[model samples]
Target: MQYSQLGRTGATVSRLVLGTMNFGPHTAEDDAFAIMDRALEQGVTFFDTANVYGGKEHRGWTEEIVGRWLARSGRREEIVLATKVFGEMGPGRNDRGLSALNIRRAVDASLRRLQTDHIDLYQMHHVDRSAPWDEIWQAMEVLVAQGKISYVGSSNFAGWHIAQASEAARARHGLGLVSEQSLYNLLSRHVELEVLPAAEHYGLGVIPWSPLAGGKLGGRSEKGVRRQNANTRFDSEGLNDQLGKWEEFCSERDLTPGQAALAWLLHRPGVLGPIIGPRTMEQLDSAIDAVDISLSDEDLAALDEIFPGPGGPAPEAYAW
Candidate 1:
């Protein structure tokens, strides 16, 4: 597996993040453990999960599954474990958001479920509009002081939100957001419009979720078509034509659609890695193999022609 520093930090991580979102709800614990085992053995040391994973009825179930895996394997020191906050774990108003109260409660709860003493990366699952930056930072400072969380991260944040959060942390002489997780892939280039640029400016690594565009880029045309139509992106005749071209291009390069898609992200700016949530072992292997499939200039140019970005970054992408 390829390795790079996490953003501007000195800590290094794999280019492929092993996302555990499907652990409890979709994958049995045994299968999840096997996947995590293989990921670590393969040198993919970054694992990302969330507090609200495992669906609504069994919140935190995913983390519990991971906790068991970590205990069984005794490999906590080998992986960079990441989990999120800001999702409602219960009905109480204090159960959600990034307020100082929830942040304090959530980290402790997550630590217990994770069966770990410290979280390598504690991410805010979303931008909680109700929580002021001062309050959030104060809580994070306490966690850092207490050694409960080594670093802080953010997910699903707008470019402006990263700016606001980072600036707030800077004023306090904090490390700020070491990473940002966003939906980014060959078919999803929205983050390139601003978020990627902002992350680069702030030295936050870009961890892309849904890196395969939910399997549309996985070479399974039948399944891809089925999912795309539901999402309204490939329902139109013109889009179907583009997807057909996409498959044809992958075939010509002797690459699986998934490998090509991941390779593209590996080449994108500010991207530390793409989070690959594999339900099966084969899928995990496919993503790991993608790290070595270098894309030439011509190959990238063709991909750009197939799945164009937002013209570049704004305001140059828009005003200029």
Candidate 2:
């Protein structure tokens, strides 16, 4: 796998990050281990998880599984582990958010679950509007001093949120956010409006989640299969036409829809890599193959014609 620097940091990470969100819920422990083993063998050194990824019934279950794998495989040092905070982990009022109290408690809890002393990259799952930047940076500073977390990151944050947080870190002389995780797929390019540019300006790597657009770009869902599914935006005729065109384009180049979609993101600027949350070994294998699928200028132009982004970022996308 190709490697890239993690933001402006000296550390380098694999271009493909393995996401373990489905470890306990959708995939069994054995399969999860196998998938991780495959990932490491394929040189996918980055693994992303969260404190609240295992679903409502068994929160933190995914981390527990990862902890077990780490204990058995002894590959903890080989992976760049990332996990998130800000999800409700319990019934208590202090169980979530980016507050100093919660961050301290949550980091300890996550360490216990992951069987690791320090998180390589500790990410805030979402921006806490009520939490002040001073409070947030102070908490992060504490973690860095304690060696509990090496780097900080944010997920699902807007463009302005990134700017605000980075400026706060600079004020404190702390290493600002090293990455921003957002939902950026061929079908969903909303981050191009501002988030991508902000990350570029602040030297934050853009790690895109759901790069397959919930299996839509992967050609897994049949046409009209989810017409009644309220969660999907594919209920419209326009979206169906777009998907049809995308599928045909992928087929023409002898690529699976998933590979084509991933290849498209891999070539985009400011993108460190796209997170691939595979439930099975086959899926992991398929995702890794995308690293070798080269896209020509004409191929990229064709993709843009099919799934256009927000014209190029900020006012340029809207005004003069």
Give candidate 1's TM-score: 0.96
Go through the candidates in order and give the C-alpha RMSD of each one to the true structure.
1.6, 1.6
Flag regions of model 2 displaced more than 4 Å. 220-230, 233-235
Candidate 1 C-alpha error for residue 126, in Å: 0.6
**Candidate 1 residue-wise lDDT, 153-245, digit = tens:** 999999999999999999999989999999898777888888999999999999998877766677655545434424544234566567778
Report the C-alpha lDDT of model 2 over 1-320, residue by residue, as the tens digit.
99999998998999999999999999999999999998999999999999999999999999999999999999999999999999999999989899999999999999999999999999999999989999999999999999999999999999999999999999988899999999999978989999999999999999999888888787744564622433475345688788889888988999999988889999999999999999899899999999999999999999999998889998999999
The lDDT values for all models are 0.90, 0.93
Clashing pairs in 1: none
lDDT, candidate 1, equals 0.90
Model 1 misplacement above 4 A: 221-237
